[model samples]
Target: MTAGDPGGLDFWSFVELANRRLAEEYGFKHQLATELLLTLNRASNIVTYDLEASVHRPHGLSWSGFRLLFVTWLAGPLEAKKAAELTGMSRAAVSNLAKTLVADGSLNRESGVRDGRSVLLSLTDAGHRDMIEVFREHNEREDEWAGVLSPEEQRILVMLLDKLVTSRDQFDVRGRN
Candidate 1:
């Protein structure tokens, strides 16, 4: 909101100004952590929005829908509970989305063989075919994003991210297996 602030300002400018304000007003000592999380979240949102808008939406899928389909396509004929875990979605969400997907002929929901109360979800033949095509486009966009970084930088970034994920246990934070 200062002289050089372009209206809402840009992400980096906001981060810079925020850190300065927090330091001046509160003597905040967590600026590094704040910046790291803000950058990571912004990057994630940007990439997710791009992929959903460009690749998934054109193929008639929302981000959540694509995630459900992708999981079923890969490890399908599995229980809805398992799919929920793999996709990081709630059981009820997966169940609801499954109804829509099934209605669209992209997914099939059936009673579990062992437990009649449990639901099993799988990609239909057409769904499988569509996923193959969509994933190709998805990977191309992923490659374009990765292309911005040198291979070594990419590798290091992945390693660091993996380390952070793996470290969740240290804080008693549970995550998908």
Candidate 2:
């Protein structure tokens, strides 16, 4: 029943033993499962923080910048408000990011045909190239992170995550408490 024995005492079982030690030896109040969940949340946050830091660019772009690039890359030659609707971002955000991307020459923006005041945005050749590189790097990073899983497992994981994200009842903007 030691850790050296494969089936005798596995990783999860070792966690159980440690849980017992904490509760029995030190008179810890919380249940083992609660403690485990808290530990899992902390680990998840730390990993996300590290991953974000690693992926951060010093080019003065925020998460909104990346998101704007993605939406425009997908649906460019698109109206500014239309891009905002598609991306689920605010009109102001799209307006500002579109201006920045236009300034950087990554995107092309012109006055709308129907409305002189309205703007339409499209990806320039450089924008497409940058998007291709970004997507390639993103795919490589995803593969590296999920390399332990088979392709089928990865598909299933994506399916499950998508379901969770798209389910309306799961989202709550305000805290219940």
Candidate 3:
């Protein structure tokens, strides 16, 4: 539906019809593929937004900034590219986020010792202490979100998602086939 449409469509009805049409008209292998992906996308947005507002923002960290610090804290010092790969963020984003974190005294970015062209990121002492406290609160938030599902249901969902995500070996960050 476009913005120029005369009437608004019911979301559930629209999705149900769209999936049926995909199966009938396009011969889709999975009729609910679009619906499943859309749900997952929405879930991601909701979780991230909630976490940022409740956990990260009060700590003076953006979501990207928090991820950078978290990864650096978990793994020791790492080059920007490695940080990007671990956090699923772009190298440029890691760079920009790292600058703010470093300026805030939460992270330290320095020229690589062995490779002068590379820059390494590591959490400062304050960052390490801060993250430890933030993590306690973060775990509580995680429990709140997961509590929506039964234990068995949550376990099954994790298993299924892991299988689907890890099954894709044909692609990489560079978009390689």
| TM-score of each prediction | 0.91, 0.58, 0.83
Question: What C-alpha lDDT values do all the predictions have?
Answer: 0.91, 0.71, 0.85
lDDT of 2 by residue, 60-130 (tens): 44556666777778865888888887777888878888888889888888899999888888888987888
**Model 2: residues >4 Å from true position, as ranges?**
1-61, 115-117, 169-177
Q: Write the per-residue lDDT of candidate 3 for residues 1-177, one digit (tens) a residue.
A: 432353666667677777877787778877567888877888889899999999999988888888888899998999998999988887778888888888899998899989999998888899999999988888899999999999999999999899878877857634311
Model 3 TM-score, all chains together: 0.83
The candidate that achieves the highest lDDT relative to the unseen native structure: 1
C-alpha lDDT (0 to 100) for residue 171 of candidate 3 = 71
In model 3, state the lDDT of residue 137.
Answer: 87
Q: How many residue pairs clash per model?
A: 0, 0, 0
Q: By TM-score, who's the top model here?
A: 1
